[model samples]
Target: MDDCIIIGAGPAGLTAAIYLTRFHLSIRLFDCGSSRAALIPCTHNHAGYPAGVAGTELLRLMLEQAEKYGATREQAEVTAIVPVAGGFDVQIGDRTAKARTVLLATGVVNNRPDMDPAEHDAALQRGLLRYCPICDGYEVTDKRVGVIGTGDHGMREAIFLRGFTPDITLIAPGAAHELDDACRAKLDEAGIVHVDGPCTPIRIAGDRIAVETPAGPLTFDSIYPALGSVIRSKLAVAAGANASQDGCLEVDEHQRTSIPGLFAAGDVVKGLDQISHAMGEAGVAATTIRNLLAEQRPIRR
Candidate 1:
């Protein structure tokens, strides 16, 4: 039985693995390899990378460092996490592994419009489709931007993006911007342009994103989708952990869920969706896990 089982291989999971291994705790890190971090082209917000680092490259380096410290990397999709007598049974398909503690870092999946697979992949590679503004909104300061979504979330994003530029456009839903009078007034006060209709046929070409609407072709230097996300916390819930409506686990101070012997960190846990924050939370969780295990280990004379 491994001392800890880490689900997901993103920054949080990798950091936890590194910490656990350094403490001589047996760890098995499992990842399905569909991390949102892998989709980012560059993240200038992270430390040490002045020019920013490709998400894939950062993940690779983290994995290499984790392995160097004796963390066993298991490239398997965790199908189920069943609580057992002592700890828990981590299942991957027909296989089973034992762990005294589990750390869930399975991050959320950003909601995206249905598009051609190749086209979406190309957009992500080109950095045209962004999910987080706090990460790179500074880079596009003073540039025209389109905030896509219909609800208050979209309006809030448009208003938030306004901090960087006043030339912001809110892409509303349906054939009209169905915002209430209060919201419309809010947008006007913020000096943000509202496009009363859904954006369609979003295409990227040569450093610009063009959207087709009833009003005509609208173009922007960049686009931010505030469509929210689907946090992957089902495994935690299935294991008796409490999660929010958005599927984010409600972790305690030690990152421990309601279920004993199970902890969480990163996007899967209720917190900011930033890499730096994720790493910090994971570090705390790893230390807590180490202390918890120490209490359970046999006392040496």
Candidate 2:
């Protein structure tokens, strides 16, 4: 049995493993290499990278850091997490691992526009598509950008991007005229032009991205999908953890969930979905977990 079993290997899970191992706690970190962090082109909001860093490069460095502390990593997916006598039984394929504590750092999957697998891959890698305005809005400063979504998420993204540039447009390609009157007023107040149409296949070029809508062909330097993400909190939720409507888990100040030995952090738990925020949350959760384990005494013979 290990002291802790951490699910997900993004900034939160990796950071927690590093901190836990330093306390001499045995940990097994499971990851499937599907972290959204690796999809980012370059993140400048994360601290210490003044010049910014590619998401894949940042993930690699953190993996090395965790491995340096002798942290064990399992390249498998956790199918389920069942609470057991001591703590929890983590199901990874045909095997189960027992741990005195569990940390769920499974991040969310972003909602993106549909395209051919290869074309989408090329567009993302080429940095013609973007996400998380908060992470790289400055990079799009004074540049033409489009928010390809609707409802509150889309409206908020356009308003957020307004801070970086006034050349922002909101596109409701599939759901034309879906924005309510209030939302339209808000967009108008923010000076965001709304284009309605069921757009055809998106065309990506070296210099820009173009979407052929019924209104016309709209092109932009980049487009952000504000449709939100699918929170990977099924394990926690199945174990009786509370989650918001958006499926984000609820955690206390120490990142403890409704279950005592089961805790959560990072994008899996409710809060800012930033790398810095995730790391800070992991630090708090790891320290608190250390204190929790210290109170356990061995059985007397």
- Per-model TM-score versus the true fold: 0.96, 0.96
Candidate 1 per-residue lDDT over residues 51-135, each given as its tens digit: 8999999999999999999887778999999999889999999999999999999999988854466866777777677778899
Poorly placed runs, candidate 2 (over 4 Å): 298-301
Residue 26 alpha-carbon offset, candidate 1, angstroms = 0.2
Q: Given candidate 1, what's the lDDT at residue 214?
A: 86
**Per-residue lDDT of model 2, residues 1-301, tens digit only:** 9989999999999999999988878899999889999988788788888888988999899889888989978789999999989899999999999999999999999877866678777777766788788788888899999888887778888999999999999988585757888989999998999988565577796689888788888898888877688999999999888899989998889999999899898999888889999999999999988889888843222
lDDT of each: 0.88, 0.87
> Which runs of model 1 end up more than 4 angstroms from their true locations?
298-301
